[model samples]
Target: MNDTSLKANFLSFTGRAKILHMTWFAFFVTFLVWFSHAPLLLAIQESMGLSDQQIKTLLILNVALTIPARIITGMLVDVYGPRKTYSAMLVATAGLCFFFAAATSFEALALARFLMGFVGAGFVIGIRMISEWYPAKQLGLAEGIYKGMGNVGSAVAAITLPTLAIMFGGEDGWRYATAVTGVIALLYSIVYYKSVSDTPVGSTYFKPNKSGGLEVTSKRDFFFYLIMNIPMYGALAVLTWKVSGLGLLSELSANIVYGLLVAIYLFQARQIYNVNREIFHTPVEPVLQYNFKQVAILSLAYAVTFGSELAVVSMLPLFFKDTFLIPMSLAGIFGACFAITDVLSCPSGGFISDKFGRKTSLVILLSGAAVGFFAMSQIGSDWPISLAVVVMVISSFFLGSAAGCVFAVVPLIKRRLTGQIAGMVGAYGNIGAVLFLTVFSLVSPSAFFMTIAGGIALAAITSMFLEEPKNTLAEVMPDGTIQLIEVH
Candidate 1:
């Protein structure tokens, strides 16, 4: 594949490029709806007469269900194809958006936000869709473009929602502003359904052997997969604890919720065992096997990169306004700078991975993110606001780029399991958000930045073990013929 020629054709909306554009736009709409509340949070607080603690809980609730939603979405996309899965998700989340806009109480608002987290899973669908359309050689850039553009949804919300609210000219302006995003989502869902496909004409759309859980090639990986799943549930438990701490749940309710999480984890483990039980009796042949450690390392990498991005985007508007005494609208624009970096940084990360090596690109970006975040930890009220914004942009560049690098490799792990792998990795990113946001609720902003810096540093260290994709991957066709797909 000639990359230069392909790059020239990026603007051509035909063939695989059309799918890329359509899918990314679908993802963009989902994220726009998912985070439509962040910039207008102050208005929400005032409108609903919410407490400070409740406002923070709303941020936490915004990302909570995304953990499981991403996992479930991964399975659904793999089984039903991205076209159907993504369209249906958009339609459902559109209703959730309307419900949130109509909320008159904090409890109703929180419930609506929790359900809206499901929209976050739309990212996983495009990961699978783009991988199916693009060859491995060009996949990094393709996926980068997909994510970089799609992620602008959050930034778009930050930059526009405040103004949209102001234009409506009333206390209920925020409510109307939010409802408009739902209308866009509802309309786009139909457009997306009619305009795209599962794959290019005549291409095979691979399916996993099982649907209940990720299929592992060995017993060790089976257990390792189970271990990795714990953190996702653990993140949920942490959210429950935090909400209970805020008096949102009673002692009995919190304890019961914890018990339910444990039961759910055990049930999931049983399903995993059923899917990979054959591994105990027969080892997977080497040609068809890939390392599970790769997935683990990438998941951790995303936890810090995209995870911190989500957490920061949610809080940065407030952080800037509080620290600099700026107006809410100006603070939101500054916050937009963080995610806007994705336009260049994310695609750059993928392009770098395509040119260099995946492991090298990931390690360098992760290390840079740690340094960038450490710099952010030093920001104070005494510092110039301009300098603070500069620090944030630089840090966001590394963080967004690292996210691009993480997904650049996700599709190479196993073509058939790409959706599931993306789902698990994406879920960890939320887990990172939940934990980091919880820390933010308890500690100062400086402490929150340092905590994220430490997490990224740890992920960088673990990334040393990541194995790069081989030149080709062998898959069995439906007719029992072995097909080798070029990866490098």
Candidate 2:
């Protein structure tokens, strides 16, 4: 079938497409609950008498746990399958939503937000789900549709929560509004659990060889995997530092958290060593071997694409207001235009990657994003407002599309390892958001755009080293038979 037929199939609820719709809606609900507080932060502050520092702390804490949560969720999904994993997460986070909404103290709110970070890991779960249901020929577009549509949950939250808050009509209206999201989540958990399977009937659900960490083919790749894990821990440390800098945590507490992070990293490294220890003594069969560089390069590219997109989304309103002397409300509309492009751009990127070659599509998309960001850096007060908005939309398309292209290649790496690989790459996207947000805090907006452009350009160069995936992947099935899964 052609792209048109496939896209038409996407609109209907049947077969694998039914699974795709259900899975993406699960993701959509997760994002909805995950970002529910963003639109209501002002009301939350007013109701709880939160200081600016405390509010910022809540935001930092919100994402702090997600860096590790994605990694943990990836492992769980591979072990337990997406159906159980996602349903459990939704149920758990529903309770968190109620807890956050009911919290009377800043400490309670902070704790709730920190735990809610797990919801961000919902993205990784569906990547494995869609890959399980879709063929290599349509995987990119399927994954893209899943992401592009599901991501609108945040926008939906932004649009609807405030109205709901007003409809409730009280100082604690935000609380009521927030609790409704939990209700949605709690109800959807059951719907998702009953509606989906790990894979289609009779299709094998692949699992990693070892449970502790990603399996690698060689000792060198083993070390490389360990090194890649450091940045995730580092991102958490950075959040700790940011909170401490705001005087939300005492220096002693910050030091303790830092020490704990180090200890946890050591524990995780040991687990990774345990999982891949066999590689140290024996070489993996050539047929089972897959390069670790694909994960590394995609992680970097996602850091540039999704990471910058998040950072820019957060600050764009202020940047637009200050640069163009527009009203803050109007600027917010303009800022939102950037993210709105994700709906179309993400699927388009995946389609491009599907129709063309993965490596070539990714290189061009990243390079185009770099150029788009470079164009954004040149925007100034002297430019026409309309022209600036055009530049923002065009640039955002490249960034969003690049992110879609990164994930297009993720699942084809190794069937059993897709969850872990998606987890690491997904986590890096969060790391990028954290690191780039930090840069935004420290530098001029123009400088921030330039920095991202440079990073994306470097990632594009890195993409040249990413070997295209083989036409088929070899997975050992139950009863000791090897199954050749067509990838391309």
Candidate 3:
């Protein structure tokens, strides 16, 4: 589509543009609910008389459940549809938000925060929804706009929630501010359900033949997929260890959590086997086969890109306040600058991927992110405040663009399996956060930045293995006729 047509399409109320609007708003609300506590974290800590370690624990808890939730939400969206899955998630988010807002103790707050991580999985639903509406040629731009804009909710929370809390002007102001976000999410969930459809009229929505796990084409891929799943659980175990080390959980409780993780991993592995066992008996045709390695690499890429985004956004305000001795309000605004870059940078990455090759775009963006993080590692109190803020904004731009580039390749991999693939990749983002944030909890700010830089460098090397998408993908239609979908 030309620029004029594209602008008109975006402005129009009918067709894919409307779906894009509704779906992005759904994602926006989910993110707003998921990170609602971030800007007001200090207020919550003061209100509850929490310790520094407790604050760190809450940040970690915020992302803990998202790792597994993305995997589950992905399957649900693939089987049911984005409309149902997103609406249900929003309802859940509303409840979690209310629970968190009304929490009277740390334990209650922690549980509510953990449950709210499920809201993060809402991102996966929109990926599938957008792929259904857009063609391959225009997919990157569309998906980028959706993600970049939706991500603004986090920035919105950072910028507005603090001010809202101030406006309410009391020890309980943060509580009321947080509750308002839930009410809006609850109302919007109903509105979203009414506004969108699973697919365009006359189009058939594809479902996976099996549920509970991703279906791989080859026996080797089945094993690889299982192996890739290990890190997700391992990240959770690391979080448990970190919390236990903080004296937050008893030894017996930590051990029980560890055992529970092991059992869940085994159960998930069996589900994967059940889903893909048929592949061993009957080999999948080459025409329908895809490389599991692509998924693995993208997962790692997202772990670094979006994962770093989560870990950094969570701690940046605190980092700024502690390191620079700035007021919390100013620190929050600075923290928001990191995420606000998404508006321009994310779409830029997608546009680059669409114009340049996908693999090439990812490599370039990932490299820039590694370098940017390395630069961030060098910042200290001696640095000028303006200079420090500029570095943060620049680093954020590269990281956000890298995230856009990663998803640009996701939908092109396998159309029908987009939800599952997006889910796995998205989960890895949280896994990355858990890993990086765990490192942050243990080390100094400089060391944490360095650790992230190392991880991004490694992910950039991994991106070299990804194969670019082919021109088209073949699928069997409901009428038993072969259909070709453009991918590149």
> By TM-score, who's the top model here?
2
Quote each prediction's TM-score: 0.94, 0.98, 0.93
Model 2 lDDT at residue 440? 94
- lDDT per residue for candidate 2 within 1-488, as digits (tens), equals 35653453777799899999999899999999999999999999999999999999999989888888888898998989999999998999799999999999999999999999988999999999999998888888889999999999999999999999999989999999999999999999999999999898889998987898888898888889989999998999999999999988899999999999999999999999999888888898898899998899999999989999989999999999999888999999999899889999999888899999899999999999899899899999999999989888988888888889888999999989888899999999999999999999999999999999999999999999999989888999977788899888
lDDT of each: 0.91, 0.92, 0.89
lDDT of 3 by residue, 13-41 (tens): 68899999999888998998888998798
Give candidate 2's error at residue 300 in angstroms: 0.4
Give residue 350's lDDT in candidate 1 (0 to 100).
Answer: 90
* Model 1 TM: 0.94
- Angstrom error of the Cα, residue 102, model 3: value is 3.1
Q: Clashing pairs in model 2?
A: none
lDDT of 1 by residue, 175-198 (tens): 999999999999999999999999
Distance from true location, Cα of 289 in model 1, Å: 1.1
Q: Which parts of model 1 are misplaced by more than 4 Å?
A: 1-8, 45-53, 166-172, 317-330, 380-385
Ranking by TM-score: 2, 1, 3
Minimum summed lDDT over a 10-residue window in model 1 is located at: 1-10
Position 251, candidate 1: lDDT? 97
Count of residue pairs whose backbone atoms collide, per candidate: 0, 0, 0
Candidate 3 wrong stretches, greater than 4 Å: 1-8, 49-52, 166-170, 318-331, 380-385
Output the better candidate (2/3) by lDDT. Answer: 2
